[model samples]
Target chain A: MTQRKYTKEKKVGEGTYAVVYLGKTEKSRQIAIKEIKTGLFKDGLDMSAIREVKYLQELRHENVIELIDVFSNDGNLNLVLEFLPADLEVLIKDQSIIFKPGDIKSWLLMTLRGIHHCHRNFIIHRDLKPNNLLISPDGYLKIADFGLARSLGNANEDLSSNVVTRWYRSPELLFGAKHYDTAVDIWSIGIIFAELMLRTPYLPGQDDINQLDVTFRALGTPTEANWPNVTALPLYNAINVYAPPSRQELRNRFSAATEKALDLLIAMTVLDPSKRCNSTQALMDDFFTESPPPTRPENLPSKNTNKKQKTE
Target chain B: MEKTSSLSISRPYYSPKELSYLHSKTIADSKKVIYNQRKHQVYQYLFQIIKVLKLPLKVLNTSMIYYQKFYLFNIFEEEFEDFSNIEKSMELDPFNVSLASLFLACKNEDCIKKLRDILLVANKIKDNQIEENFIELQRKIILGLEFKLLQILQFNFNNQISFSTDSLVLQFCKKINLNYKYSLFCWLVNFDLMLTPIGLTLPPHCIALAIIIISLNFKPNDLKTRELSSGVNENILDSLNPKDFKCPEKLVNEGILYILDFYIHQYNLSILNNYLPQINEDLNKEQIFKFMNLKSKFNNLRTLNEHSIDGNLLKQDESLSLFDYSISSKGTSRFINKRKRLLEEID
Candidate 1:
């Protein structure tokens, strides 16, 4: 019922599939309205919109973005989402916003918690990147854009490996492993975790092959001994032969991170998807429960104080 | 505002009796029989489309859920007649809506069929020849029905019965060491339930339990004895026995009756199989063409880019026109506010 209660303020962004508009409810609550471009998709609303609506409806958590309402006006499908001002990518790229290890921990904690909730609900956020991790005006991190999210119910079902962005994709996905689990998301979360710490994408590969090279270089090149059934993967033979990195090399790369943080990172970014630390395990790690506590949402760095950006 | 948790009472939580009432209330007295007959015929057509598309049971299950929800939402058409300007052209074409619902379900369930393929399939099924409106119908489904469908669902599209059937089978058959044949029977009964109003009405768990009890062919005394002899807690037995339980008992009993009715109806499958011709014969082609012509009149849509004027005007009325049917009945009023409260409580 957005026609009466919510007023579209301005166009914030536009894409081929959808348009993002800033809107205000009658109570003056700011909301983001994502209008699905009707004529663009021959089929009804795109699968992404369906996935986002379905999962977001079921998943109600602080760290997850809220789907306010869904409506059709004229011919366009509008998704009234909780207005999240600045995403993590914006804040992380902003040089002026300085972040401590605690800040990094806080962001990661929220990310893991969101991912944990999703995983517990049997959902896998296939696309987990900084851009998808939106920030509220109060500095809380919310997981958004469930477009690529899906439930991992049928373990044997061969999913299309062409999911998740190349840079953040897991090694198994890179090698064209069709049947995978939550480890794919865990790898992405680990990369974002590293990005929050380093203030730059850990593996910013230009392409799929390059992504494999960088991934193997960062975490030692996976061998038959380390990752069983590695050679049997679809694209495993296409990989560039490179010497595996040593543990010392990984430590040197993130020298600023504490030992516990490094341990959690190593567990999360393990070469084998099966061995990777899941969201729940990552939350239980010493990085969260021990020395450095995650920063409070209010105290965490905020990109903008625009009153409309304040999320309830 | 009412707590969002209470809004779970809205859907996937409705009792069979409640849903029966909903169906009676939504469908007009004159059109009820025709509507019911048309819905089953359309479901048969959806099955045909599913076979051609080679979609899994999940997509069929999802598509059926969407179809039922569309009719449930027809309830609002009467209450909110003031906003009928745009919705007037949105007539209930069960055939077209069924195809559209399946098209959306394929994507939502991750089957990912191309619109062209879906149109080709629909063309093959409907007329054995392609029609000009097939593409337009697809677009209408995406633009018209999909939005209304989601609004009716409040975006909660998880048809838990399918998933729950699998889990219940595993729990009852493997974990509790229940009858394996009975579990399979229960699983089969679930698909039949989807075709009935009971599918949309009863909770998944209640249906699963009812199926088990019905399939077990156990007398009331035997069920108790099985529980005692098997050393398994009487959880299932208690749930199955209507007297001991609360709200769920009515759901279970209603589910059993529905399943039994469905079994008796299976003999009429031949009659259902021949419904496609009857549907074609019954369709008001002139009325459909008139609605299609009406559709083109509203094609000059207000783009999201042009928003300044609509902004100020919307503030005058608190009731939203964007999707009042969705908002007032099953929108952010419950789900979003509860989430906001949850987030605030999370430190």
Candidate 2:
């Protein structure tokens, strides 16, 4: 049942495993055709492709990118994904685009909602950076690229701690804890939240060791008292100790954020994995309901409008 | 606009009658016996491969399911007919198809192993002299079949509901407070059922619940194991409800009758047969007789209504047709998991 349902108009991007093409369906609906390069290596199909297909096929949420369809052509696997032209990272990087307090709140709410859906299904989006949180044409934020995502299986199963980008990596993952949970994704979202406020990466460590120092120096070193058995982690070692940030220091750090926002951020970025607030708790936090309501999706600042105005 | 004839929506499941109809079309009468014989041998071969790889039981369970599921849509020995070269055909042998299934299963279950490493272990198990050229050809064939296996699955990676049947069986046993011996008995039944088409017919949860009910009723007092002291909990069986496990009564009944049928017919070849004694002392008969008795008792149970499924519907099911691998290469074959979405698209 192979028909020309979609037409690949142009190549948009290329990764190690797939070449993404900007395409359109027969109904003129925009789609991204991810043509996976099969049989390239001795492994045949890539693990990331399998993970993407396995998890994305099961998940269906407004805040998550839709896997429109999956088909193959000329021995190459093509994943038809909903085309998302913009992402949170691009918006955060554009210095001219001033982010309103409501805009930041809206993006955070959408991100949390998407993640809550995944966590409810027992899936952990291991790579939940701003880059993967794509924006649709109508300004909806979607969680995309589930290359490192996996479902929470048996309790005794060991997970690889060497996941999530170094800057957004959680404390448990940084210290090499294999028995972590969805708390790791919460930590990444917390960092992304901080980046939205600062308009830059919250933690810009050069390497793994620097990442640990940068993370602890910003939030305070995790000790046996705060995070029990943290010292027992595989990568835990002697490091420079630092005091936890006081309320005044945090307030000064994120001057524009409300008290509730700071409280939610602190809850999400807890040093201990068990103590970290999950997606549901984070969504239920008073920050979302307090003060100015989040900006409507259509009214949210977009890069496309700015580009068009500059061209005119 | 061009007609989207190549968009094949994924229908991951079918009724028992539908499955039989598919098999009748795919497997010729002359090749049916040979197909079953090879399937059994391949099951053992995959078990060994999984054992050597140190993969979990879910991986083996999923691989066997994929191996069986592949033959339902594709011809049993069509690969040999396509490949002209004898060496190339050898690469696409039944063992290689099983390897490809195991390979995809490992990835799907998230217990991944390198294809080369798996091939190495498989070669060692088969005692094939792994020449460099032969290994390359085998790798190519396995890789090719891996893609075909994905299409056979219709890109529906989530085959089982939440977990595979073996783990679900153990989980259900623990939930029902069954003793270790009884739980082991259920697990062994699951192991035996993995080799049958019960997985294709019923969901994992239903099959798991059915196994628990069977174990409780079977009362395997003479089950061979190190921890045989813990006797069966007869009260738990009375308290057991299918709703507690999220399994419909009809589906669980179907699973029960199907499992009883499998054991009645193929008890001697089953793994459970090895552990139990030749004669059941309580009933003063063989284990097959116990299964037969269970079958007689459960004969009145309600199962899935296949009567509503007309013969023409089964005959016209495009999903059950022999999957044309070249269709995707020619155009687009869209895979959607939900039947509702397919209907919406049709409208």
Candidate 3:
């Protein structure tokens, strides 16, 4: 707000459109200040930004970052966002801890709920990864960075397959499918789930081509045998048509997860959108319904998801 | 048509201030500053007003959300003043001022207080007087925005589609002690959409998912074989709030929270200066409305789609045509259920 003074603190980060800064309001509210630099991207602000602003503004759950204020001066748009203590990816890389299943469930539950709400509102969180998921010191998982969410209900006339970050990308998206529903999100959730369980990415393909190889090798590539209409996809013709991967390989890769967790994991990451569990169904699975149920936040063993395989 | 609207190639994205300013005067002049203090104050006032309104918290919450979503497209409509909508030849853009839309939502949905009573409280709405034609002007606004609301939200489309799946949804609601239509429909729209993802627009699979999960939660005994049906598997039962349909509690809260969030952003101060015109005239009117909204008025959407509804509607048609006909379609009933429920959010 104009009346409230904003004192820029330190340079936090930078992006395509804006320079990120840490600023404090006159009322002592610490905020993440993003100064939108003009004339950089010929396209100016994208609808993704509007969606982020609107969603952050409307979303007031505890696990969500609160939008403080919006300021425009000298043609620069200043977005004041609630300061999160730290991002999960940062914590995962920086902190050395092994998170138990219970802790994993808490983060997963909170993250899915936040994402599920967005989908219901016809909004898709195009980009979801450990970095975008902010964790408070209290162990609450608040989804931040809506810079890529597109309201699903909006008639985005032209179909574009451009969505999600590479590692977390869904097979349908990778196979060049547009008009994909909320299932793309479920796929991301699957990857996030994998990260939580294995302490590293299950499928880490380098490029789009390598990504497919890693995906099929882990989960196996789709064929007329398993995933019907696989060839109909735009990119289906481009990729090598290989037999499905053995389920035993998947079992071996994710060696530590309980059977119930594996059942839910396989269900969500299924190649078929129809077969894949949407966010709602994923929440109800047996993994979440285990004997002791998912672990409470306080009972979490650790937060690191990048574990190095130990040599015998 | 007003000159405020322009065709949208791509409007500048989130500066936060892109729509923060709200002037005490014209909407165009006042909405200049992105994050001006006055703009923030207006939103604060709106939040306060909605908070104070003694209506069903759910209904108020969703109605405010509808109002907020209406703003998201205002920029689009404002850009294309001439856009024609099939749903309403009136206009496809939302007006800067909602005193009228709010009045209609309250009149039809909330009906909490009389026009005079609401007007007395909302006096600061625009610093104008109660003209004799104010009621009639409000009528035009009711028509204009209502048409836009129907088009943008495509509540009519929702109503049409629900004719098929809602019965399946209703069956599930009955198992959970939410037998009443109010509760059933709320379960269908608010709670169901969140509690049950996967666009029901797809196929029986979406409905199948809902049934299997609801069956598991509602009457796990009835499911012939429920090892793991897509998303709702054995582990899901752990998170279940057994005491009043755990799914309902989680989803209802989600729906209410979303509506609450809608209000916080819907009352944009940017609207204070750049007032979107309330109505549209033909000839030079843009092609925005094009076919959808306008066609709905004259042509027969008839509630049939990829799936044949002849037999389905024929069965329910003769019995409840009286109730269903007054409204656009069964899907309208569903949306009215949602809008009515969400509007009650303030309570």
Candidate 4:
């Protein structure tokens, strides 16, 4: 009989499908054990848990959250993952943490590297958001929560258009495009990049309907002239035709951003997915190589600093 | 301190001899014939279900692999011996096991269908009356067996090395510029290999390359599959390299021999039999004789060397031990795919 390898110390979080527990391995390595709740849904096992195990097992990278081990105890499926105490969302929401130009570059660089690994493997991290980007103790960004991730299938296969959070959703996704590619993830990363600078969500819409209006209002309405097949999308509608933002307008909006930084952001958030820069292209952009190089991982701002200050 | 019972290790690929050694403990000699017969019936049944669902070929291929892999660790059912009276015994039905395998395979392949919907199609195919309580009961059984299926699979979803074998066959054929007839021939062989243990032994890319090599050698010009107008490009075969498809030479050799042996013995029970002519026009003999010819020619080809590993040593291998489904209930059963991680844990 196999004995328990991990001891659950305390419950950290709970979602609809799984309850996450702060745990420790026998070797005293801290880990987060996500105990998936089964027998609750009409389906046998949760699809998210299946997706998590499927992709995470194959992917091994420094910027990707490590799926340490998968074990089952008392019929509950537990995924032992590398313990990440903080996330990009926490840092973004924390007003005390001052954002530096180099700090933002580091986070974005790490995020692109992680996403590049996923895209190269043909697996799209469909739900790439600030919250999904976990920060390790050393401040390395590891892409986590593969519940919504899926490998790119055949050309004719129809993917669900209703994915990615409403705020970070791309223009193509907003128009109900079912055959979008890795560009969708790049769009999310671009929004996250904007959010890192602004210290808040770049495009915070009230609801799904408002998301399109908000997205177009900021990035300008996509038309056939800019995006050739924009009008052909399933939900394509030009209720309000806002003109594309000029370089001066974008500069005014992102006052602290460099010209190269804005260039990469613009390329990533292109309305037409085909025209959008991929992870590889974005990683190779001049913004990443310009002056004030990305801060080292350990030097990045973390939530742990605030905690330590409060205790002192 | 009492050592906590936690088994963390990666299972190595089993050779044919090791596979038979493990099977000997799970299956009795008398029941071997019955097991093969039932497996064939289940394969046909699953194929029907897959067709009705309009699932891709990869889903069917994966489901069959999972079903065969499930029986490797679990006992071959004796209660559900009679296919005609399958509904009589609901507790240990092989059909339920097949359904569970399909369910997991669908999830793994990303062509997910609801378990309830899958059950509706399965029950309808079996001509079993769809009662609400019966559906609910069977659903629970399939759900329960799903966890066991995961345990049997050891939480490893990447069964194929790269893409699914069927897709890789098409991709490799296109890479070598083989025409539609040759590609279809490789695909038909892949369809046949799915029902065998070749998938368990070799990666999909190697199997794909092996099938392509066989198709080049056989040059099935009279294949009955659609779009058979194009002729086989024999010149491309001479320039073929296993490294191009990320397949090792020895593994491809293993796949080539395994596929040939499978067709030589089980040609009558294969999808290839339905498509290809019974008598090979080139060889002036039966189809089995063509496979036999290929087998004799490749008799001295270098393949996976299993000579170093002893059969007695295989018995002592902990990963080969029969999976204890109840182990998770009593203790933790850790599944790690990487051997390096297991070594680190040991350190």
Candidate 5:
């Protein structure tokens, strides 16, 4: 009964598994159509596509990228998704733009809300990074790229540890803990928070082992005292001992952040996954309730010129 | 609690009376050997695919659902309009559609399988009349029609309250304090219903309830009969609290009558015993090609002749009545309309 007609304008983005095309419906609704490259995946409709279609169909929230429709044509599976203007990574990397700290709060709040909704529905957004967070024309952050999402694991079920990007992966995941929950996503949010404060990645490591090394270097090495049962993990025996950083050293790194904000960030980025602040706890922290409320999205500066330029 | 209620509402499972329309539709014309008599042959094909592929029971169940849902979009009337020469309608061949549904179900269930492997197994089980290349072509048609089939089915997968019947069985046993011996009987009724249109028609819980009620010999009336009336376990009933497991007497009776009718009328059909031979004798490559042509025409796929002048456009009817009424009538109009709109969009 529902009729839709769209014209393919041009290709927008291309990846190994899919190609995105810019399209406009009869109503002139701009849409992004992603066609899953067929005959490449030995399995028809790769698991990632299946996960995206399955979870997106169930989850309908404001901060989540909407999957408009799905259809197969010419033996290729195509997903019709909301066309987002830009991604958070683009904003973070744009040195020409000076972002207010309030803007960072707004983005992180929206991200947490989106991930919270997914967690409530028993889904884990296994992959979360700045690149996967898109900004709409309204400047609202929307979570995109649900390819690695999955339902929460049942009791005694072992999920793959090779999920979330290595740079943003949690300590428990790095230690090869197969049974993990939503704390993995909270850790990524912590890294994003740190990146926003510093205007660069906090711990950008080359590989899984190096990623652990960098994590320990930044946050003290985990021992039985700090993280109970720390060595029982499958890959924990391989972890090299690194001396703990002093409180002053940690304070000096993120000096730009308020003390409360820093405390929340530390809670999120804790070495112990069980002790990490979850989405709800993180949102309810004093840092968010204290002075300098998240910026009103519209009034937030899209791009700011530095005072040096004005003086010149 | 609100989520549970909404989940139930979304699936929209029907009663036997509501699904009886599908039964009549499957019966097709009352004139010749009723298609109802031959309908059971499709289940045999599904069973063959399950056995050959060693698919899980869930995959087989989903495949039957797909097969039943497929016919709702594709009726026998449109398929047999050009069946003047052929004795049996190849357009609705259960074997091919069952194989296709099974293949699609594999993907749906995350049990990935190669198209070639499935085709080989299907060919070996049935008569090898289909050439290997033709089988490949069949695979293409199946995959091509996947989206349309999904749209027609209204994406009903993942909508059910999974294992609701299993819980019901456990609850019933705990209530009566009787170790459940009715599981096998329940499975028998459920699987048999898959072959029939009953699965598409009735809620799984209602079916399970009907089986339990009959096997337990519980009184249909007396709403107050929630307490154990059976003398076998009065002490057990007294020791345990029984959850109210109630169904409308009408639904239980209808379920019983439906299964009874199937047993009396269709139980002795030849296809039930030897469907492989029937599939072999009924299906051939030429018939398949002819059926494909008919289907493509129905879908309004523009074809090229020796002169390549768009064969489909030429089939446009002379009368407005035929053009609008004939094509637009029946439940299949949803598929036709969507396919037309999608084709335009793609172009």
Candidate 6:
């Protein structure tokens, strides 16, 4: 056969910067190239575009998205990224995808390690969602999209979270905290974990207010009583009177979860930044330490449930 | 604009043709004044140490300019730096700034490169060389040379042709010179400052030529006009191959004028630092009066923000840790006084 060329692999999704194309590289390697249309700014691929390119270029870890190369021709900037066959959201939506104890544990561990790489480099992956977390065919997770990620030190000295999607967003960021460190990523991980296990968004809120409302209703409310010293956050005053979450309530909702998993969740979902379980510490948690090495995706611990199958 | 929220596409490394105009009609001619032998020794010693360091040629050119700017701020220093705050200004961000703001003309330009590798290449210089004492002196140098550097960078880039001569220099050598400051300047210009816009963001080659022309110590013929001397001429034109340039006549003249004028202007201008109290002060006053008449708009560079050394002092502490804690603190008052003197309002 003559050497094949890309025949419009489906437009998987559109992003703020580029229209993502699922294509194959010249070496016949399957890759995703994000073709960005620069606006009047003649801003060649944007800062975030270059940032993501640089960030991925430098960080070559098991859990992070590996950048192949960036393509720039004439005025257009194209980012040739690694092609991930499926993302966590796809797996989560696939009713056939079973959440065995080992499977869940492996994902959690992989996610933690991926996040750990970011924190070690003093980077904060501002946006972390299951969709952005692509799952390789072999089932390893790659944390993608670092357009907003930044190193800790800035000349301004303003530090507080400027991140978190409203739904999974931490309260600290909601108040417009100026200095955000790795804690913001940890908060997103907690939401991702909840999304994975619960099969639905743990807190599905529309806008910032809606997200806060969903979080409050699910976990009661956050106050200095629960999230100690939260009142001192850069934009802490923006939040209304805090109401502490009932630990009893989380225990009731996640009854299907294992003790270790719940413990990890609680550690990650700490109200205070100091109390949050960092990626390194979370990696050392009992979930991974006691696991049967997560049943290696090929041997999915063989779930045999027959009753009431979820319609895909 | 097709806004890419996932990516922070802020600004491009190159300047557009429209923005390449020099705001000032006439630049200062510092040719008559003589460079103080004391400061010139620093340049001579700066080269000596640069030779020892063995930096890449491209880096050498960029670094020379950075060394000059650093000297502009710390005019009295003759030695290398120990502390640095260049990074704090966000000038260290390789992803954001131009790879070209790094080098110099061929006689001055020792190297050439695409210059991307330099930004990511860190920790090449050993730590012992970066002492606290060294940083303090460097900080003074950066502070002293701030405006002098700005005039070279901002106003002079009114005309040009090439895209990135600085990066072209960096592509050639790891260390272009042995002078510690020159080596560091090469690294900063070709590698560091060229990588970030926070501290010193320079335009591309065309703009670079423009800036060099405008900052000329002697009266320069405007090259934007058809008949201009600041461009490539045929005598030098015959020696170089025409394969590289499409318009060799234009490029050669522009290129040669850039080199001849830049070093000549830069070297002659270096002498003027000693006579700040004489001809320069009068010219400076005249420039101030002329600039003051322009309506207070976006281009008014002499804002309160520019006047305050507090911000610059704080920014300088990041990479060029050359501030004397006692001096930087007490120096703020003196710095303000000095700043006022340099930026004195015309009565």
Please tell me the TM-score of chain B in candidate 1 relative to the true structure's chain B: 0.59
What are the per-residue Cα lDDT tens digits for candidate 5 across B118-208?
Answer: 8777777776876866765666655534544445444333443233343454455555555333333344445666666655655555556
Index of the highest-lDDT prediction: 2
* Top candidate when judged by DockQ against the true structure: 4
DockQ of each: 0.20, 0.58, 0.01, 0.62, 0.12, 0.01
Provide the lDDT at A183 for model 4: 92
After superposition, candidate 1 runs with Cα above 4 Å error: A1-4, A23-28, A71-75, A302-312, B1-10, B13-22, B25-40, B73-93, B131-143, B159-172, B178-180, B218-247, B264-347
TM-score of every prediction relative to native: 0.75, 0.94, 0.48, 0.94, 0.65, 0.48
Score candidate 1 by lDDT.
Answer: 0.67
State which docking tier applies to candidate 5. incorrect
Tens-digit lDDT string for candidate 6 (A1-312): 111233336577676677787777566777776766655332122445645754665577978887654433333455567777666776677777678777877777788889898888767788888777776655667888877665564323454344556677886777667755688788889888888788888888888766766766665456777767666765555444435456666667887777788888878877666678899889898877775566575553222321111010
Candidate 2's residue-wise lDDT over A165-248, tens digit each?
Answer: 999999899999989899999999999999999999998889999999999999999999999998999999977799999999
Candidate 5, number of clashes = 0
Interface RMSD of 5: 9.6
Each candidate: what lDDT? Answer: 0.67, 0.85, 0.50, 0.84, 0.62, 0.47
Model 3: per-residue lDDT, tens digit, B133-163? 7644444544445444433342222221211
| Clashing pairs in model 5, backbone N/Cα/C closer than 3 A | none
- TM match of model 5 to true structure: 0.65
Which tens-of-lDDT digit does each residue in B1-347 have in candidate 6?
42111111111221112111110111112421222332243334433434544443333334444433332222232222434555333232221111223322211222222222232221122223544564443333332232222223321221121234554333322221122222222233222222122112233443233222222222222212233232323233133333332333333233333333333334334322222232223335433232222222213222112234344453443223222223211211111111222334222
DockQ ranking from best candidate downward = 4, 2, 1, 5, 6, 3
Q: Looking at model 3, give its docking quality level.
A: incorrect
lDDT of 4 by residue, B267-338 (tens): 998888998887888887888998899999899999877787887788788778787776677766777777
User: Lowest-lDDT window of 10 residues in candidate 5 chain A?
Assistant: A303-312
Model 2 over residues B1-347: C-alpha lDDT tens digits?
64323556665567889888888987888889888888898888988988888888888778888888888887776366655686667654778888998999888888888888898999999899999887887887888888888888877888653588888898888887888878888999999887777777788999999999998889888888887466655688789989988889999999999889999989999999988999997898998999999899889999888887887987787777888776676655666667777777667
* Comparing 3 and 5 on DockQ, the stronger one: 5
Better of 1 and 5 by lDDT: 1
